[model samples]
Target: MAARYLVSPRGGRRAYPDITSALRAAEARGRAALIEIAPGHYEEALTVRGEIRLAAAEGPGSVLVSRPRGAVLDAFGAVSVHGLTLAGRDAAVDIVGCHTGTLTLDRTEIRAHDGVAVHGRPHTSVTLRDSVVLYGRTVFTGSAGLIERCRFTDAANNAIAAIEGARVTVRGSRIEGSRIHGLRVCDAQAEIVGCEVTGTGQAAVVADTRGELAVTECAISATHAEGILFIEQSRGSVDRTTVTDALHGIVTKSGAGPVVRGSVFADCRDTGINVQDAGLGTFENCRVTHARNVAVFSTKGGAPEVRDCLVSGGNVGIAVTEGGRGRFARIGVEDLAGTALRVYDEASAAFEDVRVERCPAGLEARGNGGTTAEVTGAVFRDISLGAVAIDGQSRVTLRNVTAERGVMGFAVSGEAMLQVTDSEVAGVSGGGFAALGSGRLVARNITVTGSEGLGAFGTGSAYVDITDGTFTDCAVAASFDEKAAGRLVDCVVNGTSGVAVRHNGLVDLVSLRTSLPVVRHKEKPAAPPQIVQVLNNPVFNGPVFNGPVHDVQLAWNNGHVVQQQTEGDGTHP
Candidate 1:
């Protein structure tokens, strides 16, 4: 059986004068004891060392236990506090486990003016339910605990901190107005579910230095810095969470690899998700919108795998720079003012099934050295500038790509190398494909239609090779100029208004079929037989071989016509 004791500030028959006297009497009884305190203010510190329960005679806010300094209640045994207000200048409640001690607080209010509200030491356990902690922090060091339906407001530091191997689970909590991080887990493990954390000074949640955290179904907003930060080799997962109005939504650095799934990040100032400094992360089924800078950025040797993600309304959609590498699949980028995807500065990326629409530029690869991008099954539509641009010693390969309704289709410049296979460019206002400034282009099985300018153009010492290509409805079908050199094998030009094939530089045409004539410019003389071979070409109008046509064998109505004009005349032969 349990013994019950009553305490009152005013003396009465069979009632103790103070709570200390009643506690002492209950301790001497040596059984489970309950000490009921009357509705009065007790200005004394208390320590519980036995199995005891402290309750208020009235309801909550009726009994006030206040201490000027130090902890108001120090519990070392199995202790329970119900419906009482504990206030202290240093700490409101301190639990130090002697032999796996436990403290339970139900429907209580704790106030700490300058220190922590609840502090649990090693090997202790705490269960706090329906409680409100104000003006302080709750810290667990090497302890395990559960906090349910609690409100921690106006915390001086982090509202909840678990460090030094502490394991904590917080459910149905509202942590608001923290001066520092809302929840911090360092070298510990924490699970946060169904919580709302708002107005944090720093990151809403942080896991650092081997700490593990799992956040699910939470709404974290209005953070000054990153909404969730994982650094120093920490690992975690965030599922089905929404983070909004932060400097950055999620940041992973220093070898941290966190798996984020089914999340939405919106209205961020900087990048929505940043993976840097050798960090690794997997983001799947995520949506990022209205970011000021890039939606997703991977840099400094970080390699992130992004799949089935949508990025909209950012300055740049995704950037892999500064030795970073990424693999992206099934990505959609739309409604941006700048380039949709950019890879540069010794970075490399592989993209599959990527679609970019309503952007200034689609995909850009520029670097000083050692940058590479491989794209397969990509589509670029409704673009203002070039759909794909490759520059500065970078190497890019595109297969099964389609560009429609763009200014230009593909532009390769500045010593770059581009290999395009099985591609189509349609409805472009400018040139379909261009290789300029000592660049190299190798295209196979390409089709160009409805281009207002030249279909295929090479200039400025560029080298172009096209095999089995078709150009239709272009002003000029193919033009090679300014010391450029290339070979066109088995190519056809149809419905061209201007000259079908105009050669101002070195070119070899083999088995070419054109509707209009082939014109060699008078500024540059034709090369020798091997360099300028017009072999087996069927022309509607006879070619105007202006200057020194060597090895020129034009077939007209299945008959060979070999003519040489060295005087640069406008005569057709």
Candidate 2:
């Protein structure tokens, strides 16, 4: 085995005073000398060969290499560069075609011009550790290399491109201030961890893969497109990550879906997660909030498993259309402008322990959609309009859902059938349940409570079987209006005027149960509670919030989101 060579800029009294002369002398020495560069501006393009160890004192200010006209450094054979600066260059630091060798850089700085960077392809191992690649434009390619703990800034185009069959691993780094994508992985398997990518025109990480790609402990923000995107046969996963201030928080291109877990998506213009085509994955233990369009979009294609997620502040929480399905488990969706979990267009959905709250219309099904939309053990509270609206002949099965404070708790319009069993509806604004058009309602063991407006209003509905239910504290607990008959069996109506019928209507009352809110007169009401909890994460805070202020979700979420809080042991759930 051959020994390592060195190239220094300084020399002894008998030798030269700069690195070029020292390198020439070391070449005369046949090999094996450690080249340590001092703090000086090297204004020349350097070319190195053989097995060499290249180093510098500290960062770019210490040993700066400035070649503005062209490339600064070129190397061959097995080489390692540490703490060197290739600055003021208008071209690439070409590594050429190194064969059967390892090229490594530690704490080096590369500031190149448009369409330039270290292009070493189809060769040996290349690594950059704790480096910086800044102020580069990419008409050709800015970066196609393996890097870690790096920072890329002020990119005019695509910052980094992982070519076909490239193994690019970017960890504990940042990609920001880009005119285009921060990281573009094309036909490669990528693994990115603990990184922050922001300020892009398109996307943060566009991983075009043939297989698996993983991004863990990262933050993606302020992109026009999705924050994390996977295209073509690529499977993606994100754990303990955050995406904010994006047009779409996450998107999977055609034929790809990612397993997203332990993440947060906030303030997206479109959906939190958009699946464009066909694939299958899972999203567990995530939070999607402040979405303007839809929270979770399984619309175009690709059915994914969603579980243990909290979704709030959106138009539609989960919209499954265009032949997509979902296995939803333990999810809570609230405060929507439109419906919550709208499944239509031949999309099948299943909900297990899901909560939909505070929406205008919740759980709407239209256009022959959702064959297996079975709701089990869920809660719907503080709804404004319709808790569960059905249209276009959708078949839905409900089990043990509590709907409180809504205009119409259940409205099965458009000739739809609803098989509801063991549910409670309380404090509804308009009515407890309403069924319009010809449909079948097989309701068993239901409780309607607190002032139902024409408690059970139906028209053109089929024979209703109201078996084993209770009604409490409501005036006109049961009523039928236009095109239905009344079937009163073993039913109980407490504190209500008797059932009313109007205009060829139908009434079916089996049983009912009601309860009132406990009245408590307090001496003083507590002060209005703060809505947001102050974040205490100190990582990447950059002198602890001394940097520029970014978004409003960190500031005005009830005033405590941006404020610094005392150190309380924050264990994330």
Candidate 3:
């Protein structure tokens, strides 16, 4: 008659365009009818129950359901809620017990309360697209569901909670600003892919008591707690994801350890990635930067395998502390302000084939009592302080290494046993070997060269041995630290200032020389140490061999010592 469809409400009417009347006329017993809702505000809750197509004529903005309390569509089979705004100020749209029917909610607004709770029965399929479910808890406890391209913000509710089910996928969704976890899965087979979760109290993604949660290729950041927290028997692996700006990057606790691989974790207040003792895990090929504590911490009796990682500019790169141990292979630690490698406080760990570069004090073994550490084939360069600092009064053994550019090749300050052999300490700032405190250092075949300080400084070293070694231009002043006792035998300082001194402790003296005069040995050259290396040497000794020694008056005996090595067979001409 007058260009009209039909709208079914609870009551019936005639002669006028009454939705209640249309619904009462179009009912086909157990079957449902299609009623197109008109645009504008419906002040009361439209209760559509069981098998009906309630289509909104206008868009979400034009069709508003201002219901105070009630499920908008409490239906059974083939119920579709499309393009409608269900504004429950303090209530909710409880999608209770929906089974078999594929509910498509497109461009729909489910605001406040708890948005779109799919509960009760299993095998309930829900495909929500292009929707905004805000200020409510978007929970899916049913089996086999998907929420794609939807935005969920539950300020006063638990964000996106999926529990006690299987085969759930939440993809391409933006979830933020929640009270609890932004996206949490408990006892569910949940996979969050390409989703951006941020600004939450807990983690961006939390897997607690969940069954095999796989978070792949997602960006998670800016949380009050940790970025991604896996705890309580949750076995979830985060692969190739970037998590930053959180309290902790990833916290795997409660006897649960996740395989975290190829991820970037940055700007965390605590450890970049922490695998607690309740969990045993593995970290491979991950880069962590700028952390307050350690970049990686394996704590609490948990064993972790860390390999092929680059850890730089932190206190400690990979810390295996508090009963945590690991196998570190081909890992590198560079530019550390403190000790690069630390085996701390009753911790037992091993390093095989590791590279430490430009550390202040290369390797330290202190506070490690009853703790064992073994380093094999380790190489260090540009050690700003000491190549190796032995402390904590423990026994540490290193086999076949090279330490260069530091105060000493080896500096000991603890009571421990060191077996260092077939090593080289070259171009050091001080002695080639310095023993400060109480320790037992047994080194052999150690080549020492270019030492700007003493060849060795011993303070309280008990048993020290240096055999079959070459000391060239080294040990200018032996017996350096008078407070220690040690011995160096069969070692030669062949270059310059070669002499062993004895001041306080037993500093056995080894004497050598760098005093050879040149100009007198040249035949036709009557000048003196001719200054070929420094050709213009008129002011060398206020007595510049100016007494007509020519090249032959090399011995001035001017009450001072001068060195000249011009390589013309000790000639001045």
Candidate that scores best on TM-score = 1
Candidates' TM-scores? Answer: 0.88, 0.79, 0.76
Candidate 1: tens digits of C-alpha lDDT, residues 1-573: 668888898878788888788877877777888888899999877777688888998988899998887668878678888989988876434421223488888888888776678877789998889998887888889998799999989888899999999999999999898889889999999989989988899999999999999989889999989899999899999999999999999999999999999999999999898999998899999999988999999999999999999999979999999999899999999999899999999999999999999999999999976999999999999999988999999999999999998889988999999999999899998888889998999999999998888888899999989998999988888889888889899999988377788887498998999878888866745563432334445652444466775564445444444545554466643
- Arranged by lDDT with the best first, the candidates are 1, 2, 3
lDDT of 3 by residue, 99-140 (tens): 555555677776766455433236666666787877776666
Task: Give me candidate 1's TM-score against the actual structure.
Answer: 0.88
* Higher-ranked by lDDT: 1 or 3: 1
Q: Model 2, stretches more than 4 Å misplaced? A: 1-29, 38-43, 57-59, 66-71, 87-100, 137-146, 369-372, 460-463, 485-490, 500-573
User: How do these models rank on TM-score, best leading?
Assistant: 1, 2, 3
lDDT at 356 for candidate 2? 82
* Higher-scoring candidate on TM-score, 1 or 3: 1
Off by over 4 Å in 3: 1-36, 43-55, 89-102, 114-121, 336-339, 421-423, 431-434, 444-449, 454-457, 465-472, 476-494, 500-573
